[model samples]
Target: MPKQLIIRGVPDAIARDGWWLASDATLPQHEPPSPTFPILGEAMKRRMPWIASVVFLVALGDLLFWGYVPGVSLVIFAWAIFAVACASRPPKRRVIAPALLLVLASLPMVEHAQLLSFGFLTAGLLVSVAWLRIAPSRGVEVLGAAALRLSASLPVAGVKGVLNCARAVSHERANGALPAWFSAGYLMRNWAFPIGGSLVLTVLLVNANPVFERAIVQAFQIDIDLFSLMRRVLLWVGLGLLVWPFLIVQAPKAAMVVTPPKTGIKLGLNAGSVLRALVMFNLFLAVQSAMDVSILFGGASLPDGMSHASYAHRGAYPLLITAMLAGAFALAARPFLAEHRALKPLVLLWLAQNVLLTGSAAMRLELYIDVYGLTYLRIYALIWMGLVALGLIMVAWQVLRECSARWLLIRSAIWGAGALYVCAFINFAGLIAADILTRATDPTVETQTDWHYLCSLGPAASKSIAQGTWPKLQIATPFWATNCLNPQPVAMNWREWDFRTGRINGYLAVDAKMRAVRDEDPVGR
Candidate 1:
């Protein structure tokens, strides 16, 4: 009374595992599946064409940038290539936001190739790539994590990409079928003799006929500049390295990881120590604040034998550093503020004073600039002071809300980046030039304009200088400025052309025409 089952076309293992088969019946045998290492998946195979195109397009960096200053070409190279690469493998979420930011950041590069513009562009690229790799619901912390991952992978991305591409080609060849005529073995056997014979016959003909020799010489002549060739090769490699990371977006495994709180002995950064530090800092800052209000802001005279300019110049930078240290202290003391309620007030007071101090430092810089003249450094100092003030405000907000340090840092970075982005688009050089020229012409102003510094601001300030009529003011234009005013016609292709340079060139042309007309007519002059 045993169970009997009949199976047809089944493996022996299945029949042995409980199924019964008839003795006369036959079954087919199948081999076990082997392990596989897919060098190129179906998706990757589809993207191969785009990947190849990006590689070829980036390789042309030598042609686009060589012997020319970067301008719109940088914008084109950075944005267009990145766009195409991103399109090849579209992100799952948050595409429009990053795309808009990338475009906005690159727009500055189209105007000019200043360090600020380049910096913003680089930051924009990193952030956009990071955004593309993370989830839609992710926060700035996740974005930062993804960005760090991308940056960490950059050093090896190019090599990894090349290996991947090579493996894909091999994979395709191993799996695909080729026509007999196009197969590697077939081509080698059939074409080698013909190609070799043609080369030998061409050489013989060149030796036998003068006309053939001249034609051969003309056709085969290659002026191989080894240096140029090496440079282009290096450029291609560098661009490949820079571009591959963006092309292959590697999403982070996790947005953030929460670690358990450490159960160790508490450090000295407790309530007592924080309270004492805050009290001491507040007292010290209070003293400085009083001095600033009395002497710096009230327009009162300084100590005997000390000039206002000297006082302002000496105090501006040091006070800024002091504010920065104060900000650091505020951030450190944040943890203790909750336990010791009294420390919060003290910290807030300290931060408020630090903001005041930043303002005073900015006022001091203004005073010094009024006596002397405005320069790039002073403008930068002003911008730094503003950022420090904003940071202090953010620290105060963090304390009030009892937010995490990560929250504070993320917000601070966002505000700072915004400030920098706006600063990138500002024409500071033009402002500095106009300020100096205006002060120089004022009969009551005693400031002496540094024409040398003006020249160093480059073509951006040239229009202001020209309009200031330095010749009539009895101040001769710097030789560099003269050259800028009458720049020789140098051949520049479209890649090197930028809005700033074009505007300057146009202004110079019109100014030249006006000058010529004025010289010809006495009334116009």
Candidate 2:
């Protein structure tokens, strides 16, 4: 009985020891295993497909864009591919919808690759990337932040990509032996020597005999443009850097922290300060407005020494700056508007004056344009003035409704973007050309149109130039006609061909045929 009890007790003792060993109280604690290469660790392994896609896209970009001017279709397709690749799995409809809109915005580039079109495309890309990565509820808030992050990432993305790739290869090597051909040591030893030696021997043989050199040249038939090669390589590097950030899509670790507003700080801005500023600002602006009304709208003659052109030129841009400054002051004074009843009305009056001031600036620009003829810059100025006027009105609305700064920012961005989007598609070059041509043809107009400036607007203005009924002696088959109508060194491939270029080409062909028929039939001329 004693022996049996001892055996049972021994089993019980063993069980108790095992339970204690496995229990939290007795278990030995251990830290997680450290990653050999943190950048190319398990998390990065899951993202291998993304990195691979980036590499593929970079190569595709080279194939599509290298040695060519990319068309709108190519631009859209490339951006779509990038956007799709970087998008989260099972893409949300909200995200897809906006991305599609952005991609479609590239359509304007199909007509003519203007700076406005380029800007829209660039903004679209940045916004798309931002949406994919951050998915901010409001785009206006994140747009600047995303742009800043992207700019910061661009410098280091390439180097980081290279290091990650190297680590990935090493990681794979550690997992198992790679094929001999794929191994770096194998490549350096077996492939490099033979290729290098063969090149050296081939060069020696070529120089040794003219017949050998001719044979080598004929057999190989390799023609390399050094400049072209350099350009392609640079494109690869630049494009790789640009695309890598979208692939990684690292969100900031923490939300942007806003510092709490200080209670004790006073910057001398109060109801009184705002009232004083508004009073003085209104008086100053009123004086300017009275002068503008007299000179521009009232058609009063200029002062003794000031020509109309001089007056218009001097005030056009400065008044615009002044209006912008007035808008800024109004925005800054919003906090004080509710403090004083008079402040709100005064602010509205100020904004109203600013709008009128913006209009006067526009009139000034118009007068200048009337004298000097329209150009791209003047068109932009006109558009900007319109925006400024609208913005001032929105500022007044904000003050009246007590709208948040965010509300104002979002609407302002929308208006500005909408205006730019519209401008992107408009044929401003053609408009400028037509306007200048119309003004030049007027019998009473003294200023001569700058034909060289018109020509510099490129093929977009070609149609207007070709269709214009010029004075008989003014221009007889202008030399710029051939240059604009038949742009030399035509697009090398469809990737470079745009709708605008194609239309121009088609028109040229038709025009040539018509001219030929007309030449044959003297009565038609």
TM, every model? 0.81, 0.76
Clashes of 1: 0
* Ten contiguous residues with the weakest lDDT in model 1: 483-492
Q: Give the poorly placed runs of model 2, Cα more than 4 Å off.
A: 1-48, 83-95, 129-152, 168-221, 250-268, 469-492
Q: Candidate 1: lDDT over CA atoms?
A: 0.77
lDDT of 1 at 312: 91
Q: What residue pairs are clashing in model 1?
A: none
What TM-score number comes out for model 1?
0.81
Q: In order, how many clashes per candidate?
A: 0, 0
Worst 10 residues of 2 by lDDT: 468-477
